[model samples]
Structures are given as C-alpha cells and as structure tokens.
Target: MVSSDDTYLSMRGGVSRGIRRMGGEEIYKESQDCRILNALSIGDVVVTSAGNLPANKIFHGTVIDWQLELFPSKKIIQKVVHDCLIKANHYGYKTIVFPLLGTGAGCLNKQIAWEIMLKQIIMDLSTIHQTLIEVVITLYGRETLSDLNWKFFINEMQAKWEIK
Candidate 1:
C-alpha cells in the first residue's frame, strides 16, 4: 500500500519484492491480510500458508520491534531463531531457509546480526541432526555477490556449522 498521505507505506520490503519477482503476487496479498499481520508481534513467530511460494508453510518470525528500538538485540534475534527452529522441528520440516533476520529494513548491524543469528542457529541445531537440515541464509540485494564478502560468509557458515 502506497500513500499519497504523509504516513503511507513508501516501499515494499526485499522479501516481498523477491516474492513478486517469483510470480507470487497473489500469494503475497494473501499473506499480508490484517489477521496475519495483526497476530504477529515482536519476538513472536507464526506460521501461515505458503500460498504461491515453493514451500508448504512459511514461518514468519518477528525479531525487530519497529516501535521499541532502532535496532534489534541479540536476545530478540536468539528468541526468534530458537522459536522458529522449535516450530519447524515440530512440523518435522527437514529443510528451513532463514533469511538473515534483522539485517534488513534499516534494522540490525549486519555483522553483529550475522554472529548472533548464526551462533544461535548452530548451537540449537547441533542438538537436532547436527541437524540434518539444510539452512539457507538469504541476503537479498540488487548488487552482485562480488559487491559483498559472499565467500567470507560461506566460509563462516561451513567452519561454524556442519550443514547438511
């Protein structure tokens, strides 16, 4: 929703933009209904129909409280990661793709966010299969991988976690 008024939404998020690029526009609308949006709160994780996305269910986790602070904290990041992992494991999901939460929408500092999110994920998942799960850390951007230290991130992921 865009606003001609001063307070109207000015832009769509990266995730929504990517989804739209993938031909999930209708599903995007379905996922953005008042109920789903309203039910989600900071630190809360909720599951909704995947709609047109490839997955069957999408777990929406709230790590940033736009009302509370300028950036998200380690605890908030950890909480959402832990909760989402538990929920995904409960559903017996073998694969979960986690976008580096709080790193977007003018939120957390990227380096610190990466550390906290990765540590929590590795520590928690270790108790599960190592876990036998494929974790995808999505960093969506308009630039190419050469623009960022993609190799460093990949090395960190491999060195820190025994990803399946």
Candidate 2:
C-alpha cells in the first residue's frame, strides 16, 4: 500500500496512522488477523473491511517494492491502480478513494505520481463501463497538496476533461 512494513495495519506510522486515527486502535488490532503481509507484493492488492472508517472496505495496494526502488515504474503504478479499481468494481463498491500511489515513503516524485495516477484513472474510467459511481483522489496534509501542485493539477484536469 503506502510502503508499509510487515505490520498489517500498524497504528504507528505512514498511511496507517491516518487509518488508525479514523478506524481506531481496535481496528488495527483486528486487522492483524487479516494477515495483510501475506497478501502484499508488488502490484498485489488486498481488500479489508474498514471497521469504523466511513467506507465499506479499504483497498490496500502495493504499487512499489520499497526494497527495490523508491520510485516504481509508471507501468507498474498504472497496473496497480487498474487492478484496485477492477477489484473494487467486482466487490460492488460504487465509490472509492485513492491516494497518489507511491508518492509517500516510496519517495516518488509527487507531481509525476499525480500525473500518472490521473492519466491511468482517466483511461480506466473511459474504458470500464461498470458499477463505479465516484472516484475521489484524496491528498492529505497541506504539504502534500502543495508538493503535488494542486492548483495546476486541477487546472490541467479541467482542461483535459473539458470541465467547464
């Protein structure tokens, strides 16, 4: 997912901190039973019940192997996102939220990661005629938003998608 360690959903660090904050400590404890590590590998994904979080499920995706590279290949990122979306659709999820994949501890270039993520999402949405109702790409923290050039990203998306 967000370059997590063997701890399934540890309450200590990274994206898990946000997840733990929202879902509570009990959820993290519960998640340990899920064997999240076993499901993780580059390009692999696992879906778990979100417990107290305001979503039906949390899709954990591994877009990069941290031991190998800080920034993964664009093709790998696209495939991971595509597979996650496909799994969400299969699970009958109408709405899903995605973080900029590999932009966290993976140390990916934020702007490039955003661009790749947006491009892949746009392509997927165009190709897949399925149950997906909404796809929300969320950026946490002011720093992350700034680093990602949020305004430019929005403007570019508007231009590309012909949003009026």
Query: Best candidate, lDDT-wise?
Result: 2
Name the regions of candidate 2 deviating beyond 4 angstroms: 1-12, 25-39, 66-71, 144-164
How displaced is residue 151 in candidate 2, in Å? 7.3
Give all candidates' CA lDDT scores.
Answer: 0.58, 0.67
Worst 10 residues of 1 by lDDT: 1-10
lDDT of 1 by residue, 30-132 (tens): 4456334565456666555665567766665655455555345788678878887787778777777776676666466666666777778778887754433
Per-candidate TM-scores read: 0.67, 0.74
**Using alpha carbons, what is the TM-score of model 1?**
0.67
lDDT of 2 by residue, 107-126 (tens): 76768877888888888888
Pairs of colliding residues, candidate 1: none
Error of 2 at 123 (Å): 0.8
